[model samples]
Target: MGTFLGHLLPGSFFILYASWHMFSVFTKYFLSQRALATTRDQGGTGSSGGGGSPSTPYYRSTCAHVFPCCPRIPMEGIVKIVLTTIGFLGELITAFEDGVFVHYGNAQHMTMYFAFGLSGVFDIKVSRGPRPALPNLDYVALAMAFAMEALLFGYHLHGRTPLDVQVHMLMLYTIMLCAVATIVEMAYRRSVLPALMRAFFVMLQGTWFVQIGSILYEPLTSPWDENSHSQMMLATVLFCWHCMGIFLLMAFVGWLLNSRVKRMLGTSSVYCQLERRLEKGSATCQEALQLTEE
Candidate 1:
């Protein structure tokens, strides 16, 4: 379906963006921890290591290191702008092709356009300089995007088949989760879990969008049958299975990353010293408990 493609294109952009965000956040955390361990080994505790000065722990854009000549410019921000622009244009083209603009669905397209356009503006603002801090504007933009998506889906549900409605409902749920996660991040600035969850949801949402396309457009394996309740039930089951599959994949990748970080820490003399200190403290506490009991 053309509508499915319209969703898939922008969803793909979101998937790419979210994947990059996850990688960047985790990599920075791991490297910063390694740097701290090395600093401890060298008998320094002032947070300056890894060949750079002390910077905020929020995020260190790869662009800063990759383009040393113009460290102040925000390459990631520029990329966001370009990708969002592409997504916006795709939606506009789809609207025109479907005659949605000339008909009742023009409001949906306009809402999405504003959402993407505002997000790009926020990206440009953040990308203007180096060492950019996370801004409230970014969160606001995300809220608008998610809200608009929910509205768009809700508006188009009237004439859709049961399977189509089911898929859209799942998507709407994902968007709601994303919005909730963003709100949590805004309220709890130091929490990383919410942001990670949002990224994972974005990736899963993209996968579902593709699945929707396959179910509706692919002749060989289209499972959409309006009259058959059994078919609708199977489709719902498939959606749940897909959700679990994505979660398992993410968990496996996370476990691997954790193991790698542990190995890196194990090789650090500072980490060894810290381990010994913890053991000694535990022993002392046990001895004190024995004496008190006796």
Candidate 2:
């Protein structure tokens, strides 16, 4: 994945994937919190719960809700499978040298995509198949996928410039964290923290991948000094910057979703109250009319 387009394409995919995960996680968390608050206001015992509530039930994202006839279709899994297949094919075509599979680096890249594609298949099976052998098998699949990714990237830096090696090494940290966080998420499927951490690391990795591409290729500016210690240190500092930026982005997304959810809940509450008041007024009018008839 050393080529300019190579890094950019995968990096772009990761950014979009991470953004989707973050959006789903934040929206569900906020919806659950809103439900709990409504329960409290209605004088019910509102315990801090981890799993989904009726107001925002847990289900893997699919287009089934939009098209009821296709309830069994796992859209997310399909997308993963299709896109990763295309990516895998692309790598295969490029890695070949006169009928020889000599590009070891591209082979490593292919494995990463293959792992994710297999995870997609697991998603489909779990969603469509009868009672999977293990509960949360999807999470396990995802965790393994991330672990595979980290393992491959860990060995991908051979015969590289000092700067390239340093930048990729920094990327390895995020990938390892992503694997760890995903494993934790499998255990705490209901809790938002682990999922949020996973999303954050994914986003960080995505942005860092793009950053690596820019630094090494200098598509927009002069090329970086691959041998300078100062340049290497700068890359490290820049990685920290990417972390802070992703954190802020996540925070903003969470806050924005929470506010919107609160507004929706408030609007629904007002509408319900209005209906109740109208019902009461209509009942009193009926009683008065009966008395007049008497």
Candidate 3:
């Protein structure tokens, strides 16, 4: 039971992490569009008002449509939000199946459906974008990795089964490369040459983490007899593995916050200082830029 408690805290953290991610995407999108709008209002020389905001309904009189090359580079922000929602839903399902939440003890089924419903938001968002990860796919993958990590962490808490820990941890490893890649991308953005080199290996490290974690989890059990020293060793390994996964994901998040990147869906860009004025801009803008900061 004590061991169970250890996993629970991590799980809670994951749940919160997912929530924060979705919020971040929304916030980023809102801010970017706002900035874009403001930029347009000012109509700066380089500001293209790329595609238009996300909130625009279909055929709502010409906004950014899907594109190739950048592979929906135009819709990157909003699409990520949709994926974030899906990540949350998958997590909620995993949580219930793993017994992380009871929603009043017997409410598991009801809770799961609720989880699925709420999670659908990501799918809607995803539908609008090209596949995940193209324009800096690593960063996108990094975000998705973070989302999954959060979910697993949330559910791992109550998992009495080895499957719970192993599967969750395995996915965590997959994100490490994404995280590293994201960090590398940020490094490039920040203009730090050294970090770029580090990114190459970090990506590999992330890959190994997944491969090895999976290999180790194959025979491990969550509930080793109370006295088996060997089981204790295994748990130690898992804990370390999970911790590494945490670091990788955190690194990406830390970069986003530090850089103050946009984090929203097709919410609204109506507030940017420079974007409010363009002649055709308002006509092209959509409602998705509204920041529901409340």
Candidate 4:
């Protein structure tokens, strides 16, 4: 995982998964709010618009939709399994050279991918199985995946230079936070904030992976001096920048999606009111005509 492509591939995978999770969380939330608003407008007292109950079909924690056409299908889980399987196989092939355990770094990577791939399988099982498991098996599996990642990364930097080790340590912090957040999500599946936090940290990990690759391997620029104090300082600052950038991105996406959902619900409400008024007017006119004929 020292090469530019090595980091970039996993980085891209994390970014893709995190982005899709962000989109799914935002869309499901506002859409559920729209449903609640519609129920209110129609004068029906509905359940709270919080994350769906475990008894129902879906919730924020289980927001995994890969295809818009097949919304009900567990495509996200399927995709996760497929992608992680590829990553796992690639790592396996790299780790074993002529049936020998030559590259332990690749072996480390293989474990990380295996954990996430197993989580994906659990997600599919919970999603399609008879009933939604209490305490959320999906969240449990996800938390385990993040924990495994944090564990692997914590031990991955034994022989690296100070700068390289420092950069990876920062990444370890993010992975730990992701693990903690996923655990919180497991406990409180109704709260949308924990799910959002998980996605945020996941994206941070993605971007930071790219940053580490560039710093350590000089993929696109001159090699950063591993012993320079200033280079390490710069890495810390850059990590902060990545955090801020991801936060703003999530906020903007949420706001935009919320506005669109509101507009859609607003238009529907207007149409319903108009239809009701027209019906009332038609009934009044027919009664007047009947009275005149009598």
In candidate 4, what are the lDDT values of residues 152-220, reduced to their tens digit?
A: 998998978999999999999999998898888767665789889989999999999988898998967
TM-score for candidate 4, please give it. 0.83
For residues 151-267, could you state the per-residue lDDT of candidate 1 as single tens digits?
787777898888778877887888778777766766664455666777778777777777777777664564567657787787678778877986787677666765666566343
In model 2, which residue pairs have backbone atoms overlapping below 3 Å?
Answer: none
Once fitted onto the true fold, the runs of candidate 1 whose alpha carbons sit more than 4 angstroms away are 1-4, 40-72, 93-107, 129-135, 258-294
> All candidates' lDDT scores?
0.58, 0.70, 0.38, 0.72
Give the Å error, residue 244, model 2.
Answer: 0.3
Off by over 4 Å in 3: 1-115, 118-227, 253-294
The C-alpha TM-scores of every prediction are 0.71, 0.81, 0.28, 0.83
Clashing pairs in 1: none
Whichever of 1 and 2 has more lDDT, that candidate is: 2
Summing lDDT over every window of 10 consecutive residues in candidate 4, give the lowest-scoring window: 273-282
Better of 1 and 4 by TM-score: 4
lDDT of 3 by residue, 11-119 (tens): 3433443434333332334344445454456544332246643332111111112222232232333444454455445545544545556333223323333333333
lDDT of 2: 0.70
How many clashing pairs in candidate 1? Answer: 0
Q: Over the stretch 113-165, how does candidate 2's per-residue lDDT look in tens digits?
A: 99999888877776667757677677778878888888888888888889988
Of 3 and 4, which scores higher on lDDT?
4
Q: Which scores greater on lDDT, model 2 or model 4?
A: 4
Error of 4 at 111 (Å): 1.0
Worst 10 residues of 2 by lDDT: 59-68
